[model samples]
Target: MENAILLLKHVGYLAVLRDMESFNFSKSLLSKRFEKMIVEEEKKKEGKNEKLLADLCECFVLLNQFCISKELLSIVLPCLLKVGLDKDESEETQKEVEMAFLALSNINEYAIIDKNMYFSEMKEIIQHHQEHNNLTRLAYHSAWEFVIKRFCLDGSLEDVISNELHFAKEAIKELEELMNCVDWKRTKEEREKESQEEKVLLRWLLTLEYFLGSCLLWNEKYSELIRCVVQVYQTAKGNNEEIGSRCIYSLSMAAKNRAMKNEDLLNGGAVNAILKENQLPTMDDVNTQISLKFLISITGRLKGKKKEKMKEEHRKGLKRKMFEKMEEEGYEDVITSFHGIFVLLEGCLYPFISLNVCDYFVNV
Candidate 1:
C-alpha cells in the first residue's frame, strides 16, 4: 500500500510536469498505481508452486480492475505473451493470461489506448501466439475482444483506427481472422459435449455482434458488417438449437438497424421476416415488445422506399413463407402476433393504400 502511494506521487509529478491543467491528477495516479498493484499480485502468484499456472490465468481479472500505466502494461502484457508463446510456461499461466486479456478487454473505457503505443505492438505478439493451436486459439479470441470493444466501439479509438496508419490493415486483418474462426468445429465426440461451453460461445457471439455492429459506424465495411452478422447467425444456428433461434433474432435487429441507416429494402425485409417467424410471444416484456415494434417499423420503412413492384410482391411472399416456417417450427403465437400487427397496420395505419403500394408501408 505504501509503495502504491509512492507510485501515485510519481505519476502526480509527471502529470504536473506535463501541464495537465484540467486533468484529475490524483485519479490518474491512483489508476496507474492500482495497475502496478495488480502486476505485483501477478508476480506473487507466479512465485506460488502449486497453482503458478492457474494464477497467471486468473491475473487479468485482477489486473483489469484498475487503470494501468502504459509502460507497466507493456511489460506485464508481454510477460503473458511469453507465457502464451513459450512451451515451457505452464498451462494454467497461459489460461490466466487469456482470461486477463478477456477481462481487460471488457473495461474498454479505461484501456487508455491513445497513450498505449504498446497496444499495437502487443497485437503482433498475440498474433504469433495464435499460430499454435492451443494458445493461438485463446489469443485469437482475446485479440478480437480487444479490437472490437476498445478500438471499434469507442469513438476516440475508432478515430485512431481510421487514421490510415500502416498497422490499421494488419490489426483489422487479425480481427477478421479471429472473427472467422468461430466456424471451427471440433471432433464429433466433442460436439456433443459442447453444452458446457455454450454460455461462453453465446457470450462471445454477443460480443461479435457488438464488434460487427460497431463496424457499421465506420465507412469502409458496411457490406462486410452484413456478412459478419449473417455468418454469426449461421454459426450460432449450427451450434445450438435454441441459441441459434436467438441469434436469428439478434441478426434481425442488426440487419434492421443497418438497413435503416443505409436505406436498403430487400435485405431489410428478408432479415425482418426471418426473425419475425422465430419470435416468441412469451417475451412479453415492454422492452422486448418495443424492440419488436421498432424492428417492424424499420422493415416497414424499407418496404416504403422500395421502387420495384416485383420486389414488393417478392417481399410479401417472403413474409408469408416466413409465417409458414414459423408455424412449421411450432411458433403459433408468433404467427398470430405477426398477423395481428399486419391487421393493425392495414386498418388504422393504411386503409386506402394497397398492400402492393410502397406508400402503404410508409405509415407503418
Candidate 2:
C-alpha cells in the first residue's frame, strides 16, 4: 500500500495524476478502497483502528492537497470532522484530529466545499472546544481557518457585503466567545509557564483582528464590533508585539472606514485608546506609522460641540507630548534630525489641517 501511494505521489508530481486519464484511473483504484477502509474502521467497536483511521485521514489530506474533487471532498470531510472532533485522549487520536484540521483548512483554501454550508458545524465545533477544552490548539486554529478562509479572505469586499454577512456575523460571534475564554490576567511568569497556551491565544487575537478588520467596513454592527476589537487590541498589546501591531493596524482601518463614511471616527473608546499615552511612538515601525496615521485621521474627523471639545483636549495633549519629547532631546537634536522633526510636526499638524483648524493654530 505504501509503495502504491508513493508511486501515485510521483505521478502527481508529474501533473499526470490530475490529468483526466490518469485521474480517472487513479480515482477508480483508490476511491473505493478508501471508502471500504473508512467503513471497516467505522465498524470496529474499539481497537488499533484509530491509527488506521488517522493514517487514512492523512492520505486523504495529502490527496486533497494536490487536487480535491467534490466526490472526494464529500467522502473525506465527514470522516475528517468525525475523527478531528473526537474527544479521545490518546496521542493517536490527537494526531488524527490535527490531520483532519489540516486537510479541512486546505480544502477550504481550495474552495472545494461551500464554506457557508459548514458555518454552523464549524461554530458548534468551536463552541464545543471553548466549553470543554477538549480539542487541540491546532484543531481550534484549523476550524477558525476554515471559517475565515471561506468567509473572510476568499471573496471580494462587495461579494461579502452582498452575500456573506450572515457568515461574518456568525464567525465574529464565535471569535468573541473564543476570545472571552482567554485569561487576560495571567502574570508574565504565568504566561511564560504556559507559553504554548499564550501562543494559541495570540493566534486567536490576530485572527480576530483580521476577521473584524476585513468585515468591519461592511458590517452593520460597526460600533459594537469595533469596541470588541479595541478590547482585543488592548489585551494583546501587552502580550505580543506582532499581535499588538496587527491590532493597531486593524483599528486604523476601522477608523479610516468610519472617516470614509463621514461618520464620527472617535466613536466608542477608540479615541482614548489610540491617544491613551498621548505619546505616539516615533514612526519607526509599521505599527507606529499606522498608529500615528489613525490618530491623525480620527482627530481630523472630530466634530460637533461635544466632539469638538474632546478634539481640542486631544490636540493639546498630543502637541504637548511631542514638544516635551523634543525639549528632552534639545533644540539642536530636533533640528539636526529632519526626519524626526517632520514626524513630530506631521503628527501634530496633520490633525489641524484635517480639521481645517490650521488657521486657528497659525494665529496662535
Candidate 3:
C-alpha cells in the first residue's frame, strides 16, 4: 500500500506539473481497491494491526499532495477529517491524526467546492484546533492552509463577497486568537527555533489578507476587523515586512471598497495607532497607495448635508437605482472608476505632496 501510494503520488505530481487544470486522478480501479482496503483496514486495526492503520493514514497524506478527483475527495475528505481531528493520547494515534489533517489541507480546494457537505465540518475542525492548540505545528498549519486556499484568486470569489458574513466574521475572530497566541517577547533566536509556530501565526494574517483583498463590500459591524489588522501591522512592521505589507494592502482595500463609515474606523483608533510609532518599516511600497485609497474613501463618503438630505428623501429610489447599476458596474468597474477621477486631478497635484496619511487613512 505504501509503495503504491508513492508511485501514484509521483505520477499524479507529474500530471499536475504538466497541466494542473487538466490533471484528474483517473484510477477508479485503484480507488475501489483503496476504498475496500480502508474498510478492511479498520477491522485489521481492531485486530491490533497498527501497521495497516498507519499505512492507510500515511497513504492519504502522501497521495493528496498533487491532486485528487472529487470521487477521491468524497472517499477521503470525511474519513481523514473525522479521524485526523480526534485528539488522542496514543503517540501513534496522534501521528495518524496529524498526517490526516496535513493531507486533507492539501486537497482542501476540492473539499471546499462542495460546501454544503464539508464546509462547516472543515471550519469546525479548524476552530476546534485553533481554540485548543492541540494539533502539532504542521497539523495546525494544515488546518489553516485548508481554509485559506479556498480564497485563492483562481477560485470562487463568492465566499469573500457573500452577503452572509459568516466566513469573514469567523476569520477575524481567528485572526484575533492567533494574534494573542504570538509571543512577542520571544527573542529572535527563539523565534527562529520555532519557525513553524511563526508560520502558523503568519497563516492567520495571510488568511485575513486574502479576505480583505477579495472582499468587495463591508459594513459597520466589520469595523473591528480593521482594528485587528492595524494591530498586526503595528507589532509586525519593525521586524516582519511580509505581515506588515499585507496589513497595509488590506487596509488599502478596506478603505477603497464600499467600506463602512470613516468614523467607525476612526473610533477604533487602529489607524491612528499606526502613526504613533515613528518607525519607518511599514511604509515600504504602499504608503502612497494606502494614503490615496483612504483619501478617496473619505472624500467619497463625506458629502454635504444637502447631499445627505437628498439621500434621506430619495433613499429608496436611490437604492433601487444603485442596485440596478451595481451588477453592470461590478467591482472591477468601481475600482477603476477612481482612475478617471485621478487623471483629472493629477495636473493640479504637487510634484511632492507630504500629508499625514495616518490621520484620514485610518479614519476610512
Q: lDDT (0-100) at residue 120 of candidate 1?
A: 60
lDDT per residue for candidate 1 within 170-287, as digits (tens), equals 3334435544554446655666654423544454455545543454343444344444444544555445444454445444455445422332323434344344433433332332
| Candidate 2 weakest lDDT stretch, 10 residues | 13-22
Q: Output the worst ten-in-a-row residue range by lDDT, candidate 3.
A: 17-26
How many angstroms is residue 353 displaced in model 3 relative to the true structure, after the best TM-score fit? 20
Give the whole-model CA lDDT for all candidates, comma-separated: 0.45, 0.53, 0.53
Any runs in candidate 2 off by more than 4 Å, and if so which?
1-53, 56-76, 85-99, 106-112, 115-120, 123-138, 153-194, 216-224, 253-265, 275-278, 292-364
**Candidate achieving the largest TM-score:** 3
- TM of each candidate vs. truth: 0.48, 0.49, 0.54
Candidate 1 residue runs with Cα over 4 Å from true position: 1-57, 60-97, 108-111, 115-117, 126-134, 156-200, 217-242, 245-253, 256-297, 300-364
Compose the digit string of candidate 3's lDDT tens values, residues 6-108: 5654554333322233223325465456656766656553575545544554454454444455555555666676776577747767666666665555564
TM-score: model 3 vs. ground truth: 0.54
TM-score of 1: 0.48
Which ranges in model 3 have alpha carbons more than 4 Å from their true place? 1-67, 89-95, 108-112, 123-194, 213-221, 256-264, 270-282, 286-364
Model 3's alpha-carbon lDDT is 0.53
At residue 177, candidate 3 shows an lDDT of 66
| Model 1, position 178: C-alpha lDDT score | 48
